[model samples]
Target: MARGFRLIFATSLLLMLLGICNGSTIGICYGRNADDLPTPEKAVELIKNLNINSVRIYDSNIQVLKAFANTGIELMIGIPNSDLLPFSQFQTNADTWLKNNILPYYPATKITYITVGAEVTEAPTNVSAMVVPAMTNVYTALRKAGLHRKIKVSTTHSLGVLSRSYPPSAGAFNSRHAGFLKPLLEFLAEKQSPFLVNTYPYYAYRDSSSNVSLDYALFESSSEVIDPNTGLLYTNMLDAQIDSIYFALMGLNFKTIKIMVTETGWPSKGSPKETAATPENAQTYNTNLIRHVINNTGTPAKPGEELDVYIFSLFNENRKPGLDSERNWGLYYPDQTSVYNIDFSGKGTVDVNTGGNLTTVNGTSWCIASPTASEKDLRNGLDWACGSGNVDCSPIQPSQPCFQPDSLVSHASYAFNSYYQQNGATDIACSFGGTGVNERFQPQVLIVYS
Candidate 1:
């Protein structure tokens, strides 16, 4: 193991002068659909213990808003879709709603954004028409309160709003959503607010063909994918998805508006069919996700950008209807015990109990190129691994023990594994920009004949 280094984050004067230091600002979604959740006060304590200073709630619940007061935690509060029509048609409704839920808590509770509707595109009945007007009314209400400059109004959309996302450069919103999107984009651009999106690479990985791998979705890919059209390199699915949104917005000529990940997570457990949903994968996905966001380089399409990201949930909700995975995305169980340990601080491995004794699971893990990848891809991966990848190739050279009977595939596998092991044998290490994969097989014993 490489010797670990402790990182203390502090903003320097020079950086502030240059620009906003978009550094390490990861938030969590505080969903309360379950009956067994801790009280708002207790949940606040738990969140504080995790050192997460930002939060997003589905509604501006009074108790929650009150509990969060003076905590200095930045909040992104929502107005339920059910209230949109009333808030849209009547300016009085928007004012009254904000007066009741927001005015009393402002400056103390630190409410930063008011998301007018969440994924209204997926609502049971079409409420799309209510979104823009409600946002406008909400802005007016804030403007009336003299808080409009402090608070921004926007709506959340699922990836379904995009008609295409492959290659990322070709990303475009569905024609059916055009009417709703144009005004929304205009509003966001006018307000200098972000385009909120709920991107779940878990779904993309689960539903995709053989092209996308679990490592790719989890930000553990050592392999970076090159978008042919955009000429950008994507290291993981989340960035690809985010860049797709950027491309989609650019297609409409809305270039200045920022993007925020309203929700993104992997479930910790699932039914038999959801094989990818497990505690280890969940921990890996989120742990790496925190590191990725904290690295603060932003997506390939938008470099050096610092943006906020909210992990899907705080606690599992038994009441959420759908597959078991829907209810298992939480970092914590209802009782507040973690399903698996993760450091939001972005400093350690998934299992951070360094003071405790270690137990090794019985198996040998090897990183190799995926058999599913094309031979040309493997060759390309090999060339990169031996070159810029910094892998030693002497073992596969002529007269070496590993040389005879060797083919391009075999040499490539050896090089990929060598690089993977050298880099601590992580999922990211094995990825030759998304081409290499890991394989587990029994150790082989070479026999010699004299």
Candidate 2:
């Protein structure tokens, strides 16, 4: 019995060590704006098969809530803009909403967040006024039910709320919207909920494609744009956009408030004149995005911080209003076929063929912190790899062979590569909580067998 207990303990410890290097956390937005969609149960099954563990819905659909019960998928449910006024004016309405939409589904459904209204700033003036109040009422109602700490209450906003975004360091909210935003920010800060924003770099690139390089927006840029004021170098547009929000928050004295991307994606197809919108671009954007987020590479302004992100959608909403791009942002089609291949786990390279087949890539690779990785993240990763992962650290120790010109980046590289090689050289193994890694082939290297 003593020997058996020791074996079990050893196995559990090994599993825990391997689990520390698990893949990134990513979520998808489930928008039901069209007919011909699958039932909620089918949707939930599809989500699980894709290995995604988080989901956001546009409204509190009871069908979805009940279907998702016991699935262990974290959800961020929404309250439609139309219900904002009533929910704000009366606490009873908020209480009734909880009883109907939340209380029955609590614990079973794993609902983690409640968004009062999505893009409330885009609504009318009177409607915008109700957003904060509705959020407060919902929060109060949750407290009344003893679930306030378990679930968070907040709202989502669009990048349109920013009056300026260029240079990133100078970002600020539009003065015209400040009246509504100030109170909203205060509420979110008080509740310790993230400031959710619907950010789409596709729209920004499309609007100013002449100025914004296509490679930059797609996260494939080799060149960088340097911000004059902060001396920060931006390699991708997404990071620049996120940092702009960070700067805006800092300007408002809410520097501690976290930001979560509630919606972001590229369309797989678009109408004529939308040349940049193609399957190749969509696949590239989302693939690189998965890699970036999974690597935990924070924005240039705030390195190493892990930001929660949700891909725009699960299925294309055929009836969604606006340009054709509006209806084509899904990762999968209505028939549950992948629009393009994507590896949400960030474990391996996935090639999306024109014929809808995905192929795995194998090659020589190196592991190291990303150029923009935060110093703090590197130190933490270093500690985990050498201390707990049991990777040999002598080479990076004082006066060791690889210790010449010793630095965090240099030492981390040695440890990261050691762990990567020990773990079958998989991409997921290279991710040290967003410190970052690059995998490439080195044809010049030679191998000899005895």
Candidate 3:
């Protein structure tokens, strides 16, 4: 029976064990904080022009929901923090909330995730107690409606939730938010819902330019930075930011939960001190980011795993508070003109299959750590391949064919090859902090005999 199961597993892989950790979705955050913005009807037309299929709205305004109906555009609508108290107080309240916002146009509107609140940790008041109950209440309500299995229920948190986010691997949530996050993470794990975070590398780069470079923040870095603790290669700030969140999640012992970027974008304008915020930089960041996510180029820590993201703000909000950047994150001006020219149309390009299985050419290339690198560096590279690289290392396990040689170099070679292949066999995927080298080594499929 065990041998049969192994055969089934390998067969499933050959048949393409993808789509789970593949092809990310790109969505726009349709914030309505501004007064001069177009009507929901007109906004829908603009969204359609972008040709992207997903959108996230801050509220369940009937007009917005109604306008989006039947367009087949997936919507992520939120419940504000103010409502969390009421929603968490009773199952009835959650049911009522959903009844008003969701039940009306859900199937037509294609609502996917119902976020309980927006950045509640950053809310003026500490409604920490209510976050989970609200999610539970909302989830229960969805369950009662037979929609729990269909739509996800969660909350959006800012990067403030993490006390440490550097080096990607050392990511840990603030102990202050630990109590709140523990139950919340559990709830999400049980429901199999995603952990939503408003990830902004702009904030990171803005505050710490010395630590965060312009090229890195805008996804334009020519060279990769190695995470000393994990040895994973981070080419851009966004991936490093997201991977930090992944590491933080891992710290909590919840590894399988998916992460969704509820909000992320660079601003075209900012306070003079926010020097990095320029039209050119904004365009570069978003353009590169859109292509990065849609291309299924997962983070250095989790290659080939899609982290579906929503670009913040479809239109700039004149009414938004704070610094200049707060009001300047839109892809379009209030008049609906392009803030800066960018192509948001091409969503993703990951091919599902390459047809039948085969030998050398079919598998083609392999990746391994450079033998010339120092032993310490080689160890880091190998560690990254087997660790954050998320490669299947069973072939290097005890008694396996590749396991015979035994030493770190051999095992590391096998791991790098697997990680390389799993990640589209790209040159960067082989880059275990610049210590990786690509070679035309063909991989043999794992075979077992009953």
Against the true structure, whose lDDT is highest? 1
How many steric overlaps are in each model, in order? 7, 2, 0
Instruction: Give the whole-model CA lDDT for all candidates, comma-separated.
Output: 0.80, 0.80, 0.80
Q: 2 or 3, which is superior by TM-score?
A: 3
Better of 1 and 2 by lDDT: 1
lDDT score, candidate 2, position 264: 90
Tens digits of per-residue lDDT, candidate 3, 1-450, equal 898666644433332222222347789999999889999999999999988789999889999999998999999888988888898899999888788878988899999899888787788899988889988999889999999888989889898899998878999999988778899999988777888998888888888898888888888899999999977788898898889899999888887678899899999999988888899988988999889987666787776565799999799998999999999999999888998999975444433333433211124355765768778887887777667876645445564324545556656766676677666678888788777788652344444344
lDDT (Cα, tens digit) per residue for candidate 1, span 1-450: 122111111111112111122343799999999999989999999999998998999999999999999998999999999988899899999999988889988889999999999898899989999999999999999999998988889999999999999999999999998999999999998787889999999998888737899889998888889999967888899999988898899899887677899999999988788889999999999999998886555677655355689998999999999999999999999899998999988751112222543211223566766667888888899998878875546546664434533566657776777677556668888888677777654433212111
**What would the TM-scores of all predictions be?**
0.74, 0.74, 0.78
The global Cα lDDT (0 to 1) of model 3 is: 0.80
Best-performing candidate as measured by TM-score: 3
Question: What ranges in model 2 sit over 4 Å off?
Answer: 1-24, 124-126, 347-450
Clashes of 3: 0
- lDDT (0-100) at residue 237 of candidate 3? 87
- Full-model lDDT, candidate 1: 0.80
Q: Which stretches of candidate 1 lie above 4 Å from their native place?
A: 1-13, 16-20, 347-450
